[model samples]
Target: MKLSDLAESQILKAQAEGQFDKLKGAGKPLNLTADGGSAEAIGFRIMAEAGAVPREIDLQKAVQEQALVLKETEGEDARKRELKKLADLQMRLEMEREARRRFFGE
Candidate 1:
C-alpha cells in the first residue's frame, strides 16, 4: 500500500483501539464558576439558536408520543411538567438528527 494509505490505516486502527480516547476534550477538572449560567443552559441556548427544533408541532408529534412518561409517585403535576419538557427536548433532538442525516445524505 501507499505511504498515505498506510498512515490512514494506522490512524483508523488507533481510533478503533481507543488509543486517542484520552485526547478527547473532557474539559477541565475544576468547576469554574466564571459563567453566569450553567453549562447545560449554554448548550441548550446554542442548540435553540441553531434552529434545532422543528417549526411545526405536527412534524414532531410522532417523536413526542414516544417520549418517556414519568411515574405517578414522582408527583403528578411535577411529573407532567417534566414529561412535557422532556418530550419537547426529545422531539427537537430527533429533528436535529434528521436534519444532520439529510445534510450528510446518510
Candidate 2:
C-alpha cells in the first residue's frame, strides 16, 4: 500500500480505538504562527524544546568567553595563548556559518 494509505489506516484504527481522545490540544486550533512551518524554524523549535542549541550558537558563546579570557590575561605568554584560542574559536564560528549557508542555503 502507499505510505499515505498506511498512515490513514493507522489513524483510523487509532480513532476507532479512542487512542487520541485525551491527547493534549486535541480539539484546539494549531499554533502554526509560532514557527511558520519552515524546516529551519521547526528544527529550532524542536531543539529548544529539548534544551539544545545549534553548534554555531555554542561556538559564538565560546568565542565571547575566550575574548573575556584574553582580556584578563596578565603575562605576555598567557595573553598570546588566550588570543590564539579566541581567534580559533572565532574562525570555527565563521566556518560553521559558511557551512550552513552552503548546505542549507540559509
Candidate 3:
C-alpha cells in the first residue's frame, strides 16, 4: 500500500480505537511522509488523525460564570461605597467632637 494509504489506515485505526480523543494541541502541523511534498494528502491525513476539532467554549458555563462575575463586581462596588460613607461619617463626628472639646476647654 502507498504511504498515504498507510497513514489513512492508521488514522482510521486510531479513531476506531478511540485514540483521537482530543484535538486541543493537534492544530500543529504534521509530516506524514519523508519527502513531504504531498500537501493535499498531508492535509487529509491530519484531518483524519485528529478526529474532531476542539470547541472554543462551553456556552452555558461561560454565561453562568459571566453572570457570577458581574454579580461579584457589583457587590464589591456597593461594599466599597458603604465603607467610604462610613469613614466620612466617622471623620465628621471626630471633627465635631474636637470642636466641642475646644469650645468647652476639656
Best by TM-score: 2
- Over 39-102, each residue of candidate 1 has an lDDT whose tens digit, in order, gives 6444444345445543433345544554534443378788778778767767776777677567
Greater-lDDT candidate between 1 and 2: 2
Please tell me which model should have the higher TM-score, number 1 or number 2: 2
Per-model C-alpha RMSD: 15.0, 7.6, 25.9
Please give, for residues 1-106, the per-residue lDDT of candidate 2 as tens digits.
Answer: 9766897998799799997677655688656677796767766665565566889879988999998888888999999999999989999999998998887667
Candidate order by TM-score, highest to lowest?
2, 1, 3
Q: In model 2, which regions exceed 4 Å deviation?
A: 1-45
RMSD (Cα, Å) of candidate 3? 25.9
State model 2's lDDT: 0.82
Please give each candidate's TM-score. Answer: 0.34, 0.58, 0.30
Arrange candidates by lDDT, descending. 2, 1, 3
Which candidate has the top score in lDDT? 2
lDDT by candidate, in order shown: 0.58, 0.82, 0.56
Q: Give the 10-residue window scoring lowest on summed lDDT in candidate 3.
A: 52-61
lDDT of 3 by residue, 15-86 (tens): 899776666445565655642766545544555555532121233344455445545555777767655655
